[model samples]
Target chain A: MGDISTEQLAEECLAIVTENAGKKKIKAGDLQKAMAAKYGDQVDRKDVKAAIKELIDSGKCVYGYFGGSSIELPHVEGSAND
Target chain B: MADDLKIPLLEELEKGPWPSFVSDIKSVADRKPMAADLLRQLEKSYEDKRGYWKHGGLVGVMGYGGGVIGRYSALPEDFPGVSHFHTVRVNQPSGWFYTTDALREIVDIWDEHGSGLFNMHGSTGDMVLLGTRTEELEPTFRALTEKGWDLGGSGSDMRTPSCCVGPARCQNACYDTMDMTYQLTQNYQDELHRPMFNYKFKMKMSGCPNDCTAAIARSDMAVIGIWKDDIKVNQEEFAKYLDDGFNVQEFVVEKCPTRCITVEGKEINIDNSNCVKCMHCINRMPKALAVGDDKGFAINIGAKAPIVEGALFGSVIVPFMKIEDGDYEELYDFIDRMWEFWDEHGTARERIGEFIERVSLATFLEGIEMEPSPKMVKAPRDNPYIFYEEYFAEEDEGEGEGEE
Candidate 1:
């Protein structure tokens, strides 16, 4: 609710992705929507995009398109069991 | 193998005055197995009265998702030259304009990398480098890209946007169609390279709707230049035409699609609102009339071949729109919204036309927030009296249900 730093925004984004890691890759739009739902437009789309860019560039996360326009992380090969 | 040759029947094709394709095939048949097999296949097709090959496969380049198409021979062993035959697309220059040096450079690249065979331009407006081996693709693309050339789209993406020569060479052009096309291509590079759509998306433009590009039938998004105001009529020219044995009533008034034009003695009158601006009269009598002051484009949508639905010509969506400030944000936004709707709801391989059919036109229009207008109707309705809602309402009231 308060003025959040880019680091905090990135961590929150990473939390969303990590929480739903096996279900689906994190969509930046969806993450922005979640942020807006919680923070009520206090967090801008630019902020969310910057957070995702940082997450990808930080090498802490892998960015890939599984399908569609929403950039989803590739499902880690050995991480999932059929 | 020459004993089983069908050269005489093939030669029979060359007996005509015009040059035959079989002659070209035969000239290279001795050295190229592909050419020989092509001739043999033609002869066999003539003999058997059927095609010899089927098509399917996913052959393309790495990293990129489009701009290459896979082709293979059903009988690979017999026609080995065309076995791994794949078509490479080099993004053509605007209006297909190129200097002599540029052409030679392209041909030189193709000679070194491909089978030295090429199609000047494919239907999608790419300089098609035909019959290239799969192994030669990366280097070929590298060489082409080094020459300031890149690939056009091929599979499941926004295939290259092309336009007619606007303002550059033609007098009828209302806007800078070439620049618009170039801007769109430059801006949508990611869309061009990706396979994100349910199927391929095409965008094409025409200057003044003579439609030299044939965008209406071939493109998903067709931008055709249009005029909103009355046509400028040259009275002197009209009088001269009448004096020179040209019947104004026979040629201009009678041929008007809307019956909006009329001739009284020497004076010609037009009902501007009823005029569809089909350019028929203008074309027939170019010297007598000219386009109006207010000119823009009529954006049409959803033209495609039959896949899930029947083949459809593009329908007018926006009757006229001004492409101002060298910015097409409105068009881009509309396309984005439409893409979002299609991306979310469309089935795999279903084009936007089929999607519009699957979900009624009303729903599709609602999704894109476009209002239906009278101009939307491409032709007169069979029964102009019946509204869709009225008919549906009557049907819902069980008018025919119990009787049936």
Candidate 2:
């Protein structure tokens, strides 16, 4: 929405997921909140969702349900989804 | 899969007077291999006296977090086809009205990668496809999405909003229940798909107090239709009903909790101010009585089953709010205020109803920035609630009196 396509936004989200992969479980809600902070608090939740969907649809990311739900890098070692 | 399989335990369930899911699954089993395996697994459960399905870890389509219920068979070594039988929840159309083509498409897709078992509508108002492998999650999602179908909520997400058939069938509906339900579902797609809250939240709408959907006893948020003006009455129709041997005492008079309706000779009169909008009079004498012209909705929050404590019926949050067809900013803003507070304070798996109980309704009201209303409570408290503002004000006044 902010002059960036959903694909580009998805790339940013992918980086956030990868960066926070080991430290914390970055959930879909967490991803939007984190990206909003990264982009000077300017991010639409719908746009973020579109980006996240692109990540999943493209097989760059995957959803894991551990108590609740969270997004993660695909095909990672010791991952539960496999 | 076998040419001749014997499921003695499951076959007994098909004998009941009520329509049986056992029979329904058997029909599906004839086509889908996984469904056949599912029947076998279920039969084993009845024989063994224990369920084989276990779910804890995550399994869903590539991007989406909700709609898929991840379940793995504990007895996978015995039944391989039903091993990773996760459930896919397809968001049902508002009022559950679906065309033949839409249903055929769903059935076709399920035949491809699913167990072919379905719940006509789950508790959360989604058309639930019972079983599928984890690997098929993406493909299943793709097929549904391509055909303009979307998934419903699950796992700490906002459950799909449901409504009784309003303008579609019932004439008592003061507001358009389907439109409101669909609008909220579409607008809150992000909240519905993701775990926005710490726990699950359910929203159910009813067109009138008859509450065919049972929104009052079940959902976290309930939108029930109401009218501000007097009940519309036709005296001639009222006489006609009574003259036709309609039992006035047993049907209309007794059914009204408030006892506002009075039968004078042949005509029935309603004390509009005292009328509670129970809709019994209107239901019994549809030709004679009707809902008022000034229509709106009565909003209630925090109704759920016993979990943290005993069951809590929804308490009225807003007595009435005009729900404009296109603009619902007031309603959305009120919900936003509630969510802001609940999201900040509620612990994991704690419901909004439980939160109100834990913090007391007074504290909950303050948290949500809602003013105290007489309509919000069933009766006056035995010991009146000591709100923070009133308590502080009393203390401040006491200081001056003490000094004197």
Per-candidate total of colliding backbone pairs: 0, 1
lDDT of 1 by residue, B279-395 (tens): 878887888887777777777778886655677777776666677788789778878888878866777667887788789878888998876655465521121111133234454
Q: Candidate 1 chain A: minimum summed lDDT over ten consecutive residues — where?
A: A73-82
Residue range with the least summed lDDT across 10 consecutive positions in model 1 chain B: B379-388
Candidate 2 pairs with clashing backbones: A65-B58
Query: What are the per-model C-alpha RMSD values against the true structure?
Result: 9.6, 7.3
- Give the TM-scores of the predictions, in the order they appear: 0.75, 0.83
Q: Model 1 misses residue B225 by how many Å?
A: 0.8
Interface C-alpha root-mean-square deviation of candidate 2 = 4.0
> What's the TM-score of chain B for every model shown?
0.86, 0.91
Which ranges in model 1 have alpha carbons more than 4 Å from their true place? A1-82, B1-15, B26-37, B40-56, B378-404
The all-Cα superposition gives candidate 2 an RMSD in Å to the true structure of: 7.3
What lDDT score is found at residue B4 in candidate 1? Answer: 42
Return the top candidate by DockQ: 2
Q: Backbone clash tally for model 1?
A: 0
Model 1 has an lDDT value of: 0.70
